[model samples]
Target chain A: MVLILKKQVLRRLITIRSFSYDKWYKVESERQKRINKKAQDFVKDKSVFDLFKFVTKEGVSEFKKFVQEFKETDNKNYKPYLEHGDFDYLYKFNTKEDIENWLVSSDSGYKIGKTKASLNLTQQNTGLFSGYLSSDYDKPEKSKAIYTGYANISSLTEQKSFKRENRINIDQFNCFMLKIRGDGRTYMMVLNTPSKYTLTYTYMHMFPLYTRGGPYWQYVKIPFSKFFHASHGRISDKQYRFEGLDVKSIGITCMDGVEGPFSLEIDHIGVLKDNESTEHFAYETYKIPKYISNT
Target chain B: MARRLLTLNLQLTSLNALACRRLLSSASNDDKSLKKVEKTEEKILQKYLRKIRPKDEEEKEEEERKGPFKNYFEDEERNKSAIVFYEEYFDKNTKQKDRDNFMSALEAFRVTNPTKNLYLDFIYGALLKMKEYNAHTHLEAYRKLMEIFPIGPIKCLTKWQRDNMHFPRHQNCAIQILEQMERNGVILDEDFVRLTIKIFGDWTHVVRKAKRQLYWLPKFKNSNPYPIPSIEKLENMKDIEIAFAALERMCMSADNATRIEAYFTDDLEEKTKDNFESTWIVTAQSQKQAELLKDHKKSIPIFVEGPFITWIRSKMVEYFVMKTDPDPEIIEKIKQNENYDDLDQNFKNLHNMFNDPFRDEFSKNKKSDLSVHELTDGTIFALCCTGTGTKTSLFYWTKILEKQISELKDFIIVYKIKPKPSFLVDLDKLKNDFKENQQKSN
Candidate 1:
């Protein structure tokens, strides 16, 4: 069925007149987004519908309102906090250290971990199945959903020089693919005194569908390695006292490692899972009135 | 009254939001066997993911799990749990027939059910690019669509009425809908007029939102009416405005964002090639664009889309001129014909006409009971007067005309009702004459 569609569209393209190119291009590109990618991949293989297989650094072919990135000024309480104002800061990150210092902070007794009030046990509300995401859990299986829990540093409002990011920790299980959105380096609209941004993607774990990164509203998927590297903790130890870098606090940060109101909209956040296991939905996936997907 | 699409047969399953929750988070299991990359260091991670997939789904249903910490979508399963809730709602709550009906009805695009309808009252705008009475089908589609969106129709009607000071009559469906909402008292005076316009053609809106929405439509997994442009008729006429009414309707909308796309130059299927910025109106319904085009600098026309610009650059007008006039002199006539100074004026008239709050010129020229309908027709006519790659200005059929003119006796003076791109202008002749006059100085 899909093959017939491919033939029909290509045939039309062959004969389309000179100017309709834009409109045709619109439909065609959108069409390609819809069926073309899958069909082409299918040609590469018989039945390749796996989401990861389709993640050609090219993202999934679906649109959601959440994909939109907005300036922090527009609506303060909007979902999906900004990693930094305008997606540009990350392009300037000169080294891993620069990003690390900016991403992780020490808040006296409040590192970037589960609040002292809440134990790592995940207050009943923060369980993996139905938890609110314990701050203590950087693990995907126990997430505060980066908006609530991610690289946090101190004194973002006032900065003397600059700060580097602590590496992210893309654990082995995380299927995040590190996909770049713009000319590989996204341009930031807002000004960063330091003038740089370092961005790493979490790949094929069906991100973009989840994290919705940055202010420009582009898809970002990172490899587990990049994810971990971008989110990893700093190591500080001497014979006297060794401490694994745990985020006690973070303020507004940009990729340039600036202060205050850093924002990032992760397009999707999931480590790639290699599976097409036909597990029946706990509730049968069925159609609804006029709209919606079946589980 | 005459519907373009069939009535939507809204079939809803019991809204066991609870049962739906069970299905929502737990649908997919973490299958380790399927993902045997055989690499080890990562195996530990997969093992962890497997343990949490379903457990997370179950947890999402508990009232405590969702609201507070839902923002942290760190992994696929929980991320899937929250984001995929809508899909889950449909899967568990709906029936197989309803799914098929939803899929099939998308073709008809008419709202069938009053409740549980998925895409109700959602503002829908299409640059029909198709002329003739049949264009009214879009109206019916617009009307029905207004009926279904979560809060769209009622909001549209009330907002329309308040904006119009009464129920909108003789206007595009959007205005009419706004008026209807007012009469129905389904919405408030402060309801966002812009949003209502996006759904219908209020003076402030254009269907650009719909265009952007459709632009991103392909990104969804298993979207209903997957493989958009499902029907063959929609295939070629994707963005072609069949008539002035097409654009007029969208222009009449209250929302500034009316999605307008330029038809590509017929051959480019590549994204990089399609990146012409002069085209594609990112700034929808902004007065700035209309103002910019009037400047002597000949600022890029905001309405002109990238593909259209490419079309102009493609020497398509040259192609048409060659075809429409085989005589060198005749081709010269079309080429020599300039619409700039006066053309700019004409463009102004059309712009003012299009920008007119009442769309009076459109109302005057079009054959319609609704002023909205008439105004929409006028806007489309203006576009047709320019170029749209079809029988309009780009002259897709002009190649055939060229063949005919070669055979016809008096083909030198073929006049195009619309202006086309000009290449090899007679301005060269003026340059030559200027040189001759300069020789006298020598």
Candidate 2:
């Protein structure tokens, strides 16, 4: 019996070992890397799924040209975040400068330091906002700024855009901070050159508003048509690209630009770029057909 | 006697010769024509040499006396295919270990003669269940049986599915099936990914749990790296990292440190804390700020971790000492909590930490409960008294602070519970009296 059982068992083990499989080892980070590679390959692979890939080189350039040349609206506050090359960063300034990311509520009411503070010395120089100044440093130029600040907000009285300029020329591209009331977080929008300047580019330099904080996680979407119409001075159905740029990422300016008596906290900042959204690349791609038609 | 003896001897010799020839020749013969005649003639002397079972006559009598053959396999054929059958069934029925041992007997039997279906089924089921089914050694067995029977992956998968009928929808069935599928060379495909996604569906819910279980789940060797990413894959990976970390931490075993290096997605290479810490702190600070502003609460403590809290406590102490007899209760509370432990070696962060103690204190204590106007009033009051305050005579202090804080244009009347003439109108006097009053009351 012992011999029988032993023989049977030994035979089974040896037999089973025949089918025993060896396992291949894989780690997660490696897997993630592979996933990314596969996705990229799948996206770029001509035969597989390249139909949905982002716009390529010529497409980007042409879109920029169209945005610069043909925008359709002039409403001043149609703010937008556009992609650009590298990114626009301003010169760091005095730590104690009284600037804010965007305006929330200032206790009694009204946006203090909401309007760009002009230099008492001359019309040119104004209080600093967080951005690079042209040689016109002391000389005031109307521009929306992303600045650091120190104020515990009571509420955000206003979320609507304020008119910045009637006519916006594509002379400059900028990246700035926006202190929105929803969640009372600082939002950063990087505006590349090919933007609908009059409306899409207004809020960055437009004056501030005060309102109670409500609708914490809500996001607002306005018609892109209105945005296009704002590029012409005020209200004419103007078309302007104000073009030229590429942007890698749009996020909150990494540094704490506001150094008042207190540390100004910043929340996340990103652009909601998607299909149908008018990014520089998207605009350029649309313009190619136009350029072809003209020729 | 001689004539008679000779005649008898001749008869005996002839008979013996004939009998011997028949015995030797007809051992391989077909018929028994001579056996019928010989049996009637009573050739009983050869009865001892006839073929019989290996039982003793007495034992057979005893067995017959006792009962019929206890089992057919216990008969004379015990050494033949009967023993093979008995060995396979008994080994498997008794214990797993025993079945394993009987495999050789079964093999040896097969080597001698192929066992029929009943015996074959017994051996195969036993081997498969014992999880001892081997491809190489049992390759012949596997192949032979497969040729005889068309049940492979389906049998195993179906059995598991039947067993776990109530196993929470597709969760366990999918697992068991896929595992078996992997066992067979189904070739891992998107179906496996789909099954996983189907079982867990949206990554949002189980991203954490699956990430953890994934550490234990055998990971295939593949990687993903790129500039831009897939929307779908991104959705899948959204919360997988945390889940992965948790899985890694939980799945530690002796050899796991090595084995799970593959499962753990965390980079083995060291990352500088500088970038990560600053980002974390900034993110947390901003989150806190958002929470405070939207909710109208204190913004500083959003990132109030141990070090930050400790710094705040120490700053509170400094602020307390910066003036004479600062609220003892507040100082005492800080001392008791010992919120300060191992912290910034130096006090560089003091400014951000409790720099505005009165406002910070009021924000903590009041805004959480008060209406907007009440909150603003307390803040304004604290600000004038503590804002740029100097340690001077109490009388002058009250006069200065009172003059300043009274300018607030915003007001909401709050019902005070003070006793007769207990309240002081002068904001600065109010601060002094309130402190003394709180101390006395406590």
Candidate 3:
């Protein structure tokens, strides 16, 4: 089943654009192997029916619809939306129901011991992502593995049809803005953008979100150009500018390695074009010089 | 008696036979038999050695019995425990818990425990005590702590030694010190780099951690938009003074029209029978927000919400906001005034409106660009962080505001206070708590 999905995504990628396909395919396969290895550490093997425990009945229908859309749609009709000229909220946490739009998960659920994280509304009606992060892991028998702590609150990815993601086009905006109250901790805000490869070759652009913890709500304006592409927690050597054409979701991750209670209260998230910022991309997109060659 | 002697003689002869078999096995050089003979010989040798070096074995047993740490409180005549020692050395020796005293404590511990047996315990203990002395933020304390570990010998010299984690416990402790320094937002200097290299060598993990700190710390040190004063300065300033600085930062406006007002609670007209120490209230109001407060309807009640928390560095300060409910009529007007920012949505709406002859209303021109100030569900008038987050204190806040905006006198203000539970209520703390408890019981 996973193989079929992989082929479908690869086909879509090849149809849309051209690249060094063989090299990317190698990198993607290597990444998939690493993921599978990590997954195997927790469970011996996952059968096809075991996948149903995660993918619901509705998910199957969604996949079917996605396949149908995949057949019909092309690069021309991909995520066509009017460009936002002014500030508009992508996600607003004004009420209890608004908090439901985000899904919270942590390493604890994957048999990692003791760490717990959750998201809920505070008395002030803001979404409070709070929990204790513990580094202690329940060691499996004869396993030489170390489990670190990580808890993330990710916004749900919307799918219009059989589409992988109902991409929100905010190309007109330059800055991603949010109002948040945090406990003086640094968080990583990861932007999920569509890539030409499989899910393994995820194009995640992340930037540090430094929060000044206090009573006052801080309005942070991070330029989209500041985001640098990273996959599997490591930045790519060949960097590229962040194109906000098909943004799917944003994830806020807390993994500072501090073992204690943490909290982040979010008011709203939006996008705007800051007139002051002149730099197109914070990091250089040119290929880094390699001193050594395999040949 | 004869039968027992015969049995003893047979056992001695068998021992001789085994010794003979060992000799024969060595001569023959048969692999399996030679291996079996060597194993028995090793067992006999181990038994012989145990008997020979009984004192050395006893000393090792004694060392193991003491566990991972040495008991510094072994001197029972004076009965000075570790806690008492800390109190005497840190508290009684110096009244001021400054960097000097902190270093002196480390010096004193080193002098007393010269053997440095289980030094990791001492380092861990010192780390816990450093927090109480506020020495966790001091670079000198970390330097002193790092200096406590004897250098040179523990340093991993070769690549193999570095890879295998030579002196792992000590290296980890050093990394932990660096981590704590990072946590306290301490910027490590070049002098510290030299010290780390000298102590742990260039290739050691401790040096790598220090190098990482040196690289990353400077980048994020000045990144905070609302930067607080140094811990040294904050340690000296009063709570109210700190609150003023924080409130000033929080209420900082781009136009520079935000006015800060401070007054003592004792200055209020309403006084209680029992006079206690007065607390200061630091309130901030912008000129535009003050104008909005004046124009607010007298019939509509204003809400003073929150005992919200904001951190001025590590110190927590509770604050309140005075705001009016967002009127739906005004919200609707704002909505009608707002333009569809999406070009496609505007085009579609225009097409629909043009096609229908009966539809007369077109997209209205945007009234004004929506600023962050208008993004709130409620219009905030003023903000304040007070020493006491009580209804009476908030009422005094309104009374103070009434002097600035006279129209506030006619408005009915409602306090939505959810103050944190603290011990200090008044001079007679117990009595009021008892009364509140009784009221709750009813």
Candidate 4:
């Protein structure tokens, strides 16, 4: 009886093992079927759009020629200052005497600390904004003792073309390229719009010097879309978009809180108009009102 | 007897021979019949096995045929077949899943045929144009293609990185993939983040949005704990003071401040601390200026050079310091009770008072009636001086100090100049004596 019982147990075990094997095989085959279906579907879908075509050399030259033609025929509306290599409108502080007419000096130490800034022509006759910053945390309890030195392309002066009414039409340009040499410190490019009877808020773009402590010149290209709006040293919650024509002034500031002397050299500043430029407003987060309804 | 025995033996032998012959005949007949039955059973078993085995064999064969390519020749054949499949099924209504399958198959082909893989670029271009394709699908196809032919997609990404320009749809798709990867707990490399930023961070709006989303990514948040405020939240805020205050709150959150401090270098950390301190001082100064401006009918020159400004600054500091410090007695009482809901409500009230002082004063007054004794002397002074009635201050104080003051419910707390004399000593005679002394001096 014991032998018979043992034989029965062996037979049952064999049957269970076979049953599990069959189940596993079914699962694997089902998975393979799904993968096969996906593979087959992938082969069934391929088409190309016109935008995928690479821009060739001839295409670029042709586009430039077209832009030139557009400028020449439409001279009154189209002004290509940098495209034609026109440096007449470009602001250059070639000598110490010329600095007064072209730029205004601002330093935070004048009010609280002992920060001083000087603008001098380089030995190479290039425009330079150099400054000494000191942090005096002892004078007042609430004093930050920070010193900042900056120079603005004064729009209030005798240059009528640089006035608020005669602002450059940025809609026709792609970007502003500045040839600058700096000492690795971060710098800010500030632009202001014309306001009546009140101080206008400035829009600023802060970028760091790619190379530091070297005399090598770096050409920095800043698009108008990169500037963020600020008023009185505070970032604004609302960003107001203005056309290139609306810009009244441009300036550069360095205030990284590194207590030492800093220097920045300027070679030239100009605008470039490239057809390949993506013109859509880069910031898509700003809300746009659907309609101007009278309340 | 011998004769009889021999005869018996002969008889037995004959009987035995007869029995043996009969047994042999029967056994042979039985064997023949058993053999026929066994052949029929074997034939039936073969038929049953044939019926069940074909289905499994066909499935196995199909899988083997579609499995990974064995050699370059097989890969080439598969590629050609895939091309034909694509050409045949290429239509506007072709589903995204079908395109993905074809790309995957081509990927498998490319894996086997690694050299001279030019067909992938064509497929990628075509996939780029498909409206049904999104960032995830595009990413999957790109990744598979990369696995087989790593050079193609890398080259494409490099070109896009160099030009710093991408179609809006492509850019959006890349952002979506990055977000999805992050959501799945995948830690993306810095290069991926940098590439995404390069492609989409050009516009102010995109950068603002990306900054918030990227800040939460494990890579960004782990490295830098600063909470990036959303542009919508910042833009909707009308007051700069309130906005900066909100920023301060975010910076000071328990999970963030320590991590952010660790992220900053020594010098940067010092500067950041100074900046925060200065911001609070500036806020306090501004609040004082606003309060002063509100009191006078005419505009006043609040920025007096000498001691006046310093005095105002000191006062502002004092007010802020007093306002921020919670009463220890009340805190102890709250801790003892462990009534967290009441504590949270009290904190809410404090925040409301900080945000807007006058909008819901009446409602606050009604709520404050039950808890008035918690008011510190300095708080009462500030409330009265600021023209928020004594009753409101008492009410606000009680809410915070309810538990502490419950024992003192029977006592009426008030400011007393001097204790009343036990007996009435001032009489008309004392007044007359003082008057006579005054007359004598005159």
Q: Give the C-alpha interface root-mean-square deviation per candidate.
A: 31.6, 32.3, 15.4, 31.1
CAPRI-style docking class of model 4 based on DockQ: incorrect
Residue range A159-211, candidate 3, lDDT tens digits: 67535467777776678888787866678899888666686457788888877
Candidate 2 C-alpha lDDT tens digits along B1-442 = 8999998798678656744564455444524534554674565545544434366786655433212112322345334443245345434444544424445544554555553444432432333333332332232333232232222322323334433332342233234333333333223333334334443443312222333233322321221110122222333352323222222322221113212111111232135633221110000012222222333322222110111100110011001100111234443443333222223532221112122344335324422232111110011111111111223221232333233344321322222212222111234677899999999999
Model 2 has an lDDT value of 0.29
TM-scores of all candidate predictions against the true structure? 0.18, 0.15, 0.63, 0.28
What overall lDDT goes with each candidate model? Answer: 0.29, 0.29, 0.69, 0.41
Q: Candidate 4 overall Cα lDDT vs. reference? A: 0.41
How accurate locally is residue B117 in candidate 3, as Cα lDDT from 0 to 100?
A: 55
Q: Let me know the DockQ for model 2.
A: 0.01
Kindly give the number of clashing pairs for every candidate.
184, 68, 7, 12
Candidate 1 lDDT tens digits, A134-237: 23333333433322232322223321112223332212122222222111111121111121333312111111222111111233333222211112221111
Give the C-alpha miss distance for residue B105 in model 2, angstroms.
Answer: 77
| B211-251: candidate 3 lDDT, tens digit per residue | 65776557556766666787788989998898888777666
Model 3 bad stretches (over 4 Å): A1-63, A75-98, A105-151, A156-174, A179-188, A191-206, A210-219, A225-249, A253-295, B1-99, B112-117, B266-277, B333-364, B369-376, B419-442
| True-structure RMSD for candidate 1 | 32.8
Write one digit per residue (lDDT tens) for candidate 1, span B1-442: 3342332221122224433553444334224322432355388889988866765646646423333333333334443434343333333444553323333333443434445433311221111111111232233333343434334443334444434433232124344344333222122222243445544444322232232233232433232210122222342452333222233332333224434433333432333653322211111122322222222122211122112111110011111111110224333333232111123434222111112224334323332222111110011111222343333333323222233233322322233433432221244587899999999999
TM-score for the first chain in candidate 4 comes to: 0.57
Candidate 1's C-alpha runs over 4 A off are A1-97, A104-295, B1-101, B104-442
Model 1, retained fraction of real contacts? Answer: 0.00
- Worst ten-residue run, lDDT, model 1 chain A? A235-244
- Candidate 1, residue B383: CA error in Å? 49
Q: Quote the positional error of residue B386 for candidate 3 in Å.
A: 2.2
